[model samples]
Target: MSGHACGSLRHACAALAVLASIGAGTAAAQQISPAETLLFETEHLARVRVPATLVYAFRKESNVEPGFKDEVRLELAKVNGKLNATLHFLTGVHKQDIPALEEAHGNPVLLGFLEHDIAEMKRLTGGSTAYFRKRIRMALAEGAQVSLQPITYQGKTVQAQAVRIQPYLNDPMHARFEKYLRKTYTFILSEQVPGSLYQLHSSLGKPETVRTGTQPADAPVIDETLTLISVTPKQP
Candidate 1:
């Protein structure tokens, strides 16, 4: 073959290879699902830096309690690869001073409660450890759901995921409490930053009828909301 023809053929082959490479890359990107992408992003964020701090502001409102409002500040940090959180209640009926708590202990009050219950279950079912373990695993699996969504924060649209966790209360007393009580918690977490939370809102209370009338046999009397107003990253 002529040298010119050979050169042209080689160039064509090179172009085809480049196009094939591009096609493969596009296919791989398409194969990544949203959940997988989020997991990858969060995991990447987690490994980025240690001892990072996040700050948030909280607000609480209640319908039954007239003129009821609560303000607080929250700080979340990762220290030595462990998570720590502190809650500072500014003004509220259930106001109190809380010291820094480790994540294992569920730093936030509700999280602490969950951790406590799980620990109690482990202690109680020492003989049937596997059974209890399985129960807890199944409960978590059933209660947890995640979805990719967009949120507006600080005048910018950012990608986020809504994580809903509603573990089953096996304790008879706890079940009784939920029977007549209503509770909701919303946590706003960043998709790009692992362990970074923008907001958390919790609302729990009894119905108006229960509040006005005689208390039911087993009804939890509680009303409150906790919100995260802002998050500021702290230098290591």
Candidate 2:
């Protein structure tokens, strides 16, 4: 761990699940749905051979504050014939090991972005990440609506699965965090993409008005997106 990692990063990282190989599955024994399979059980990184580098574009828009932009870089390699990942988390020297194949094999873009958002939510609302993570996990397994949708990747259209969930809409803290009661998170994934995860869109209180591409007066406080830009392969 680095100096910057000793702070909030260490606390929020608990959201990233590192499971046992007992089945490389969840602790509960039950039938898994397509949404759970796509989000967790699928080997998203195996579609690409190591060594590789995945770059993602990160952007945040808010009605109350300045917009922010950055890029997340992930380096991929092979360790003991399994996909090993080293992520330059969001900023600073906070790097960590992500055994993409052995545990939580979902792409870092999905896990890391959500982890970052959950951390921010904690900072702003004083809520526990475990509460949010459980709601999301349960939503994927029990409440998510999965469907195939066409998305553009690298300037071409490809078939992707979109998993949409609203983890906090009916949250017990409804009266506490009233502003974000309408928060929603959407994930797009495809086998064609190297890491399988294409994009994650999250918005709170965004509403549709007329067809002129205008937001209502009560637009969301925060609108954020993390999308895969490209993947480059290197000599292993």
Best by lDDT: 2
What are the RMSDs of all candidates, in order? 17.2, 7.4
Total backbone clashes of candidate 2, pairs 3 or more residues apart or in separate chains: 0
Candidate 1 wrongly placed segments (more than 4 Å): 1-55, 75-86, 89-93, 101-139, 166-175, 178-182, 193-195, 204-225, 231-236
What is candidate 2's TM-score against the reference? Answer: 0.78
Quick one: best TM-score, which candidate? 2
lDDT of 1: 0.40
131-221: candidate 1 lDDT, tens digit per residue: 3333333332334456666877666688877654433344233443343223443445664433444455444444564667665524543
TM-scores of the models, in the given order? 0.44, 0.78
Native-vs-model 2 lDDT?
Answer: 0.67
Pairs of colliding residues, candidate 2: none
lDDT of 2 at 224: 85
